[model samples]
Target chain A: MKADTNLSEGSGIPAEARKILTQIETDRAAYKRKLVISFIILAIAMIMVLIALKLDFRFMKNQLPFIFAGMGYTLLVSFMAISLACFLAVVGALGRLSKNPVFNSIASSYVSLIRGTPLLVQVYMWYLALPQIGKALEGYGFTGIQAFFTLPALTAGILALGVCYGAYMTETVRAGIQSIDPGQTEAANALGMTRSQTMKRIIFPQALRVIIPPVSNEFIAMIKDSSLVSLMGVWELSYRAIKMGRRHFQSLEMLITVALIYWMMCILLQYFQEKLETHMARGDRSIR
Target chain B: MMENDSPMVKITNIHKVFPQDVHVLCGIDLEVKKGETVAILGASGSGKSTLLRCINFLEEPTAGTVEVDGITIEAGENDKLRNGRIRDIRKRTGMCFQAFNLFPHMTVLENIIEGPVTVLRQKKEAATAYAEQLLQWIGLSEKSDEHPSRLSGGQQQRVAIARSLAMKPKVMLFDEPTSALDPELVGEVVEVMERLAKEGMTIVAVTHELHFARDVADRILIMDNGNWVEQGPPEKIFNNPEQERTRQFLAHIL
Candidate 1:
């Protein structure tokens, strides 16, 4: 391989430089070969997908619009839930990090309890158990309590998801805040800034750069997790797919279609996550 | 210079004890007159930095009082200093750290202006103008918009100095400001401190750089085991120290 470097010989380049260039050219060729192999693998996966569909393309095409219509609800639940989760995570993290015993216990218990229980059970508790508690209160002469407790399916789904994810994200947020050096806090304090002021202006802003990427990752997972809301009889993508599949007795087809849709949505979100990571990292000299 | 006899900073019997009976500072007392520079020299863990931190209450003294620019804070079990009182003392004293500790998320100019705008509630434009001037003084005007991570260690330390100066503090505290820098880069930061000292800024520094202490400080104090072993003018302390401990420490370092 080294003997074939006549390309740069006439350009008066040194032997060491020409050898390095040859290595780079070899690397580029290997990368191109790998790219071609990756595409072939993807083509094989597509063929597997076709076999899984059992050549029922017409049925999938016809059901696509009906299932796609529920996408709005799916996205809405995830977005609103994630927003609520972020707010709760910040508060919970602060609570967990607080010096006061009461705040610390409340934050730790919230995380422990939520994370310990199953999300499905929590969803049912929000949609079903709350109304029962409200009814019990109504028996004590609390007028309109049952009605207030009985939430719509979408609202209950968002609450359950948000509370659950908030518990998980509390740890993430706490780790991000702790990742910052203590010197930063001392510097801010030395400048006469109050504790809260230091946190708001100096600590939190820097922590956000560390927290955003993982938070985005949680968001992608929530997109798929939002499907759990379908059990509440909401018209989200999964509910619509399951309902249509049962009606037409093609459950496998509907399930496969909905799975692909969720995968696509996550891919789109991952793209946006990379863009956000880059934006947050602008202060750093290294882009990646 | 002798006309102003009032002390800019006064400390009385300050004692600091860490948990588990680690007595880091014990019964230390000192005073600095206005416009005078005091340099403290000691081996590491001798409480030199802790005493400086006590001045701004970054490390609260378990006993004794620290009075800065006429405001006094005393340590006692029943008497807790209010938040406002701590802020008042902190605002009057500027601190420069060995690691620079510049806010990595902000540009150099923003880092400088942060204390002015947030703590002092100065107008943004006015704070920025002062920050720019400080940057120019430190010869970092060209790097104003750059983040602290992008600058060299020397440049970041200079920027850190500028950040402290933006608050217009009555006194400056340097905690081994040049100890973290490369040997070649230490000169730039030391030069800035020398310039500041010459301009009549009151400074108390804990440093390992012997040249900086000798050339820049008006008075020098040597500490060992949380107590001052010797104190005098730099020439007297460096050439003819009274204490055996101070002599040994200097012999090891110099």
Candidate 2:
């Protein structure tokens, strides 16, 4: 009976609702200020672009579709690479947590080796060194399909991006695991659940709130960096941009168009990321 | 479905040692009767908590045996029991942490039913009914959909107790349940524990709460430097302590 009264006390219209409403209004005002500041910053940056190269906007209309075609490739490469990275990341994280010496060492070396080397070198290795691997396979009494295999440019690009991002994701997942309090696992263990069950049911769900933001950031960056695939001749956005520019001899126009495309993509992605973060946060919120 | 004839718990010659020559539990020897409430008290670093951990096998004893309800934690030079059996032992013992480590992700109802559905494989309807009852017992029925962050520290601790209770453990261990809570909120959680005590649950509590130690405890064992200094009925131990160290601790706390 007593606790019932207290429960009613907690929910019967919070006294600070007015204050909270005012705070919300203040936040709205802050948002408007932020928008203005961003607009000003963009305007200034655009002016510099015009002044530096004597740019003309009339050409922007002509080049838009060509630029977008390149963007399509960039987007494809990033999406495929990110999906692969997610698989590698989850498996790699599990490997790092495994008790076996070999699993832990292999995962550790993967993260360590990838993180230690430059991304450019890794791209080169995947492109240039793989033929040697194929030839070696041929020497090992392997002939038909295995002997003379060749990775497509797109495959090489995906491998480079996936392997690089997976290393970073491994750490993100590790931090997410480490950030969770030890007691959650202890409680799960105290329950009749196995190790994997505990991780899946208790640890992973909570870790998502921490993991989502960083992973989204990585995906956005990958979109821009997918241009690196141009080196391997994957005719993605940047590759097409360079080709289009060389043909037109209006390199500045092509580059400016490419920059605008990236800006639009980043903006759209940033909005979605914010929405997702808020959505994930709703589960853990205690309205009081 | 626990049987009356099954041994609830049995522990013998539990020992633990740490590096740098520090001994956490030199040789812990204790037995808890089914439906008995025992309170263990120690000044500080006396291994009272360690002894409880050993019972739960959270910390494996360096060289001894512990059994709960006919299940033993110690193996013969090598652990032979399958992984599932070990989990059974853990499920049978409900533990209330001082800091109230509630899973922040789940709702209060979800927290309570997690062990039941995930571990015991109880159906959702049954687990929900049981969690509702437990939450009622802890006075958190209305807050079932709320997260731990929305609740106060005392409320979170009560939710933690409800979460543990959802599993229907045979024995419960309270490691200073009220220590992390504010003074104002301590009584509510204590009231719930007092009811649990009255229900004749087998409980082992380590606490500095003199009042609870005085009122609900059937027996009080005092520890100092990883050894039991003395133990007896609550009245005799609190009113007329036999050991000098016990007296000094009582005086310091009182």
Please report the candidate that would top TM-score against the real structure. Answer: 1
Q: Which candidate is the best by DockQ?
A: 1
Candidate 1 chain B, run of 10 with poorest lDDT: B75-84
Estimate, for each residue in A1-288, the C-alpha lDDT of model 1 and write its tens digit: 544556545467677877777798899899999999999999899989888757677898899999999999999999999999999999999999999999999999999999999999999999999999999999999989999999999999999999999999999999999999899999999999998999999999988889999999999999999999999999999999999999999988899899999999998999999999788776445211
- RMSD per model, one decimal: 3.0, 5.5
Candidate 1 colliding pairs: none
All candidates: DockQ = 0.61, 0.41
TM-score of chain A for the candidates in order shown: 0.90, 0.84
DockQ of 1: 0.61
Those runs of model 1 whose alpha carbons end farther than 4 Å from true positions after fitting are A1-17, A286-288, B1-3, B76-81
DockQ-based class of model 1: medium
Each model's backbone clash number: 0, 3
lDDT of 2 by residue, B153-225 (tens): 8899888888888888899988889998889988888888889989988889999887789999888999888
Compose the digit string of candidate 2's lDDT tens values, residues A186-262. Answer: 77776667888889999998887889999999999999888898999877777777788888787887787787788
Looking at model 1, residue A143 earns an lDDT score of 87
